[model samples]
Target: LVVFLFKQALTWIFGLLVVEKNLISYPYRLFFKKANKANFSFEYFIYPGLCALFSLYYPKNKSNLLKTLHFFISTSVIVIFEIIAVKYTKLIKYKKWTWYWSFITIWITDYVTHAFHKWFFKTKFHE
Candidate 1:
């Protein structure tokens, strides 16, 4: 799926940039012997996969309440998982970042990506 692929790539770019900037770190990662702090599993796969599904099924031309509710629900799920991961699995370690920061980033990224996806569909790959 182009949507999934694009979202996956975008997530990796943003996630890696965050790691490189030292805003966040991943002490535990997958598909690598040494942790690189990029969160390959989550960024390259999990989160984008979730995004793909969400985008595919997200209601269109919906009421503002529905859209807001959707965003809040998705953000809450992610934040809860992140909290657990940070506390129990030690998967993520925040240096200059905070949980609220992650929340806002996720919220903004989702909306922007969704907008791009809609535009791409409308343009039929012309852009």
Candidate 2:
């Protein structure tokens, strides 16, 4: 209900901020002087959207320890897979590794959004 809406709103705000920052600085720097490629690829949107959805469905009673462990494990696993995929196959290149900032940003953004949602929804943090 209220929590869901709050999460959605916060997610939208964070998404906009990321886009603006990329467009104003990162994209220009990556493309112009660096001669690096930059574009609105699928991962640009997918990671953040997945983060938002995960936050929305997070267990309310999960202990803080468990939640933190889950976060690290999940992030590490994804990073490892990406690294392997880039290294072994030509699926994604090394240059694209920097693009993972989107994942990190979304991770932080989702945590903040979850905090706000909890505060507004009167949800209690466990452990």
Candidate 3:
């Protein structure tokens, strides 16, 4: 639950920013009909779940380069999927957003969340 909450917190923060600023949007979603096209459900659940999974499986003791590579690959795949979705589906519509913006944001989000996860667990467990 903590993992889910942590990721959702980050998601809400970043997700609200882009949506409220009109940088990106989701015209179709399962819930939150009044938040414009922000897709708050995705931010609050699906994405946070995925990010929590990433954190849970992350190799906390690995070298920095390997960890960086993992983040790059994970975020790049997401960006590629976003590009394909943008081309083939109505899942997301970018106003001033681009692929790089998604990549950067995803990377930073993962990095920040995972770093916190590591520190939190390190201090609280196996001591």
TM-score of each: 0.87, 0.46, 0.87
Q: What is the C-alpha lDDT of each candidate?
A: 0.82, 0.53, 0.82
Per-residue CA lDDT of candidate 2, range 1-127, in tens? 5544554565556544544455312332222333333323323444555555566667668898878876665566556665675567654444323546645854575577667766776767667
Cα lDDT of model 1 by residue, 6-123, tens digit: 7777887888889999998887665763756687778877888888877887878899899888888887899889988878877888789888988998888888888888887884
TM-score of 3: 0.87
Which of the two, 1 or 2, has more TM-score? 1
- Per-residue lDDT over 1-127 for candidate 3, one digit per residue giving the tens place of the 0 to 100 score: 6678888888888888898899998877777677555777677877788788788777668998987787887888778888998889988899999999999998988888887877777755653
By summed lDDT, the worst window of 10 consecutive residues in model 1 runs over 28-37
What are the RMSD figures for all models against the true structure?
2.7, 7.5, 2.5
How many residue pairs collide in each prediction? 0, 0, 0
Q: How many backbone clashes does candidate 1 have?
A: 0
Model 3 clash count equals 0
